[model samples]
Target chain A: MNKQSLVYTVIFTFIVSFVFVTLLALANDGTKERVQLNQELNRQRAILNALNIDYNGPQDVQDKFQNVEQIERDGVTLYRTTVDGETIYAKEFTGSGLWGLIRGYLAVTANMDRTIGIEILSHNETPGLGGRIDEPWFKQQLRNEKIVDGTIRVDGAGDGDTNHDNGQIDAITGASRTSDAMRTILSRELSTFQQILGGNS
Target chain B: MSSPGQILKENLWTNNPIFMQVLGICSALAVTNLLTNTMIMTIGVTFVTAMSNLTVSLLKGLIPRKVRMIVQTLIIAFYVIIVDILLRAYLPDISRALGPYVGLIITNCIIMGRAEAFAQSNPPLISMWDGATSGFGYMAVLLVIAFFRELLGFGTLFGIQVLPDAFVPWTIMVTAPSAFFFLGIIIWIGKSIMNREGAPA
Candidate 1:
């Protein structure tokens, strides 16, 4: 009955793993619905913000989102809504950031000529530096931004306040690498977005 | 066995994980830009540390010597996943803000270090107390670091602007390297104070 015996070791490891993992599974099951609901709300919120739709809170976000239609085609999901007689298409995008993957919603007009806005759903960038991508000012810059030369530029150099023009946005100070990553992410996503939605135009 | 007060004092000052052993600095830096994020992340770490310690202590007698590390790891990971699920469900925004850092708790050495150093030898309840105090020690330093980073970098505390409109933020304060400066200063102050008390930890 030695605790160090190989047979005991194998049985002990299996039991311990089973117990801990089962506990985790139970916790996961208990919260799965709530988590999924949170995710759905968050996604809806991001789409709303990117399209410059105002929502008060959770209930309002849910209410406002009802008008928006969900479209799944060409292996992608797009949220379609009309704002002020303008047809807007919003889609979730995943791209590389400075530290890890950055996921967000990119909303553009029907003609795909201008951005309705963009809201970062999640990112692993430094909280104060690169993470500023989610701040009011940064996302504001993307609102009604003009997409030039078939891409949006996230590399404005401390430019004087020229938001929504020249197709350039300022890189967050002290976060140039992350800014560069955003530039790449935006341009690439914009192209893919065009390819996916272009046929409809 | 050390009294609860002694354990608390030792962990908070003399044997602080951040200031003394300097463990768990990566998360300390990553989540410290904002006080709220720091608070939540630290609390999550505290919960993980305490629960894992209690479980490890309870299981120590039965754990196989050759597989102890893996068992301890599974225990830690189990708790981390639960924390993550709870955050995602109940506090979705904060969960998104935290990003992968919650999952990264599995890699934080403080949990494993406590399991091997204190939990393996201590009784279950006190070992849990020891782990919780160790987390508080880590939390104390991180909160201090977050205070300075958020204030100087954003001219705000907890998202409320305290600095005037004319005040310019120290951009570096919001970046990763700035964490090193703040953490070092805190550690230096802590050590000097400890030395003055005729006890250098």
Candidate 2:
């Protein structure tokens, strides 16, 4: 009942802290497996979506992902899928954006000469501006575009003259930094992919 | 002391958190761009507020005067983490969609306000009701704003196309600035209605 007593405050604080921490630890333990599974599933789904593969649910994802093989070639992780006797590859890309790291999947054709598709997995870009990079319209620009000499250009100037044959894409209007970041990421990742796949092909 | 029904009515309409008290507008503006995100955020906020209120009320008798705020904050944070974990485990898609906003629920003023003003003095059951009704009030306003934003911005409600093909989506409504105008208009309309109802006959 002594509101001013230091002992009471200390004891109360300790008890509350102890109880809540224990509760959180227990909840975290309970959800650990499920959370990890969900995260893994999400990553797989992003990879599949980037490859333009159709999947409906977790079961479908697993079934379709069965065709994809994960390989660590020259310290770079690549996902390879063979459909109708042609191989397609996807690799995770992480690069600096305007605010933080932008992570995504880059799917390349069998010869590593063209991009099959691109899917942004996560980014800390400012919403509504740089964040528009995650929108389908922006990503669609990277789909089926040729990757020339392990480089891609993002046209920052509002010129609609981006050459698809030369691996050039238009940047989101208000997200020049993010677009530039994406360009840097794709260039860097393409070199890595070429190195990993160079000896095999 | 007010009756339980009066408390519910007061929180839901007369003293609504968003339109009346304006207690938690941060999440409102951030997540109301999409109806789905708003709904998920509303549920998460409601869970944290109700559970935190109940926990705070139960411990009110033993809480010291100087440390009550700290204790309340601990409870709120604990519940918020639980919500985050559960969402990651069971509703990973929504969890990822919400990003850091779920964690931000711990800092929402409405939960702390209820804990200090109502839960610290009321019974656990009543405090829970008050917390839940406050959340519901906040959610109602957010959903209304989201309805207009998503409908006009994305030309969809709950991700379904309701607007005709001839309708052009408003680009501004998909951004945070759009929520400001929508929320302001709703607050204006809500206040005029409340004022009329409160006027002398």
Task: Write the residue-wise lDDT of candidate 2 on B1-201 in tens digits.
Answer: 779999999899888988888889888899998899899899888888899999999999899889889999999999999999998999998898899999999999999999999999999999999999999999999999999998998789999999998897777888889889988998899899878888321
Q: Residue pairs in steric clash, candidate 1?
A: none
How do the residues A20-124 of candidate 1 rate in per-residue lDDT, one tens digit apiece? Answer: 888888998999999889878888888898878998989999999999999887888888988888789988888888888889888998787888888888788
TM-score, every prediction: 0.87, 0.92
Decoy 1 TM-score against native: 0.87
lDDT of each residue in A1-201, candidate 2, tens digit only = 686699999998998899899999999999999899898899999999889898888999988989899998778788999867778899998899999998989998767778888899999887767888887777777777888767778775442433557787887777788888987888888888787877767
Each candidate structure's count of clashing pairs? 0, 0
Who wins the TM-score comparison? 2
Tens digit of lDDT per residue, candidate 1, span B76-134?
99999999999988998898778889999999999999999999999999999999999
- Quote the positional error of residue A169 for candidate 1 in Å: 4.2
Off by over 4 Å in 1: A71-78, A94-102, A111-114, A124-127, A146-156, A159-201
The alpha-carbon lDDT assigned to residue B54 of candidate 2 equals: 95
State how far residue B113 of model 1 sits from its true place (Å).
2.4
Give each prediction's DockQ, rounded to 2 decimals.
0.75, 0.65
The docking quality of candidate 1, as DockQ, is: 0.75
